[model samples]
Target: MPQSPTAHDPNDIQEFNLDAVAGILQDEKLDYRIDEHDGEKVIRTGFINAAISFILLDGSLTMEAMWRGAPSTDAAAQVLAATNEWNLTQFAPTIRFFELNEGTLAINALRHVVVSAGMSHNQVGSYVMSSIESAVQCFEWLEQQFPDLVTWKDEHHDH
Candidate 1:
């Protein structure tokens, strides 16, 4: 059996559904796909030029964006510094960066809501949409500082 997006009061705390979250994305007319990954439903989508994902892990929703290209080794420090600066000033879905290696960096926007009586539909949608915007903003900032990292293949989608 499958579930559908269930409506709830904004104040309701116990009932939350990813399907409903997916429905909100649909209502917004965004292209998205939801599939099971490692026993959790992973939502695959994008906002503007950034790829976005939503995952249910350890009872919280994790939203993140995949950076289009990895920066060179020389730019790792600058990337981390910028990420630290952004984390300090940003609110609601603070953007972060993962330094996978000297030559690889990834950007992420994250929000966590505990399971149980959970966030309302509006809250979920807000988190998802806001994270998308935040990730794009972070990407832009990175691009300004590290032009060499903008190796994204699609010019139309490369911001």
Candidate 2:
């Protein structure tokens, strides 16, 4: 026997909006402020001694965490090796090394959420928190694996 189709209420369809995302973050008790760079919405938050920037786009949201200081060019090969190793193991947020001004190496953690598929508010919050946690994990991993290349900031500061 075939099952009956469920009713499709209009409310079942969700419209992904920046304001909604912000509200969800607020509801989840995350302290964040919205900033716009060149008219693109960016949610700025801090976690685990690193600054997090969440970019609100049409169909997706991206969270990026940058390290405090850059490493010297001599450690670029090590950084690349770490990036490759982490990328092969991790699936959610990714780690990458960037060449900053003066040829210094900067490690960054990136997490992206595709919202066009209709994610719930809880799901969004989980994504944001997951990204934040990923940043912390990546930072700690680097500190443990490449202590010579990365100098960790003082964790004495409040979270």
Candidate 3:
């Protein structure tokens, strides 16, 4: 007879770590590096020239994608309107706009996940992939909305 499926224990828990994140990235065939920033482990990955970071913490993960297509200050109002619309409608990544300089308005796609009760490998992987996919869609929509105004500013390349 086929073996009975095993049930996942609700009490099974462990500190969320970069090793798991690395595995997820590898399984997805995405190139990434686990690095330290202010003593916290971060998994860095790139989509084209855009940079995305996965921050590891106890029972939690935060993904932030630094969008390369930043709008100029002259179009700040338009950018803000687009962000407002996205926030009001979408469910995945949260968009935050910051005035990086007098001329450039930068935006980041941020998502936070908390699994205090622990999660399965596949569950976590779903969250990781979905986060990336949503951010990409958001950037694409914004670019389409302002094709001429959007300017690329890859943070990884400036230095």
Candidate 4:
């Protein structure tokens, strides 16, 4: 049987690792910073934080999507559109932060919302993947526009 949405508490969402994500942001040459609050750590770069805020706001706008119970295609499209908008907004803040700091760590503390947003896409089938693709495209565009601002290296896991 399908579990009802009411059974889930959005606030009881899981936490994501800032370190892993931070490494990715760093590889992309996005200035990221970390901070702690109430035993939780946040990993954000100025650009990432801004982008996340925008995406969260936009995704909230589509909250009705959950209630609509529409076709998967329609749902996917809506998710993609909102995700793209969020990615764009996120990009601006990150870029501005990069310009201000010149590729220094600028991310704020990690928040439950960021984890929730990622979970929402991950559990919702292609919605999250589509959103991720959108974000990747934006990142690529940013890289192309500012080649010096982005960099990457082989994964060197220090045990």
Name the candidate that leads on lDDT.
Answer: 3
Residue-pair clashes per candidate:
4, 0, 0, 10
Best by TM-score: 3
> For candidate 2, which ten residues in a row score worst on lDDT?
7-16
Shift of residue 131 alpha carbon in model 2, Å: 1.1
Indicate the residue-level lDDT of 126 in model 1. 78
Better of 1 and 4 by lDDT: 1
Assess each prediction's global lDDT (C-alpha) against the native.
0.72, 0.76, 0.81, 0.35
Query: Tens-digit lDDT track for model 2 on 73-148?
Result: 7878888898899899988578787777786877888887787877665666677778888888878787777676
User: Which whole-number lDDT from 0 to 100 does residue 42 have in model 3?
Assistant: 89
**92-149: candidate 1 lDDT, tens digit per residue:** 4566667677666676666666655577777777777776777777777767776776
- Model 3 residue 75 distance off true place after TM-score fit, in angstroms: 1.3
By TM-score, is 2 or 3 better?
Answer: 3
RMSD (CA, Å), each prediction = 5.2, 6.5, 6.2, 15.6
Top-down lDDT ranking: 3, 2, 1, 4
Task: List TM-scores for all candidates, in order.
Answer: 0.77, 0.78, 0.81, 0.28
Order by TM-score, highest first:
3, 2, 1, 4
TM-score of 2: 0.78
TM-score of 1: 0.77
Tens digit of per-residue lDDT, candidate 4, span 82-124: 4355446663212211112333322111111234344421233
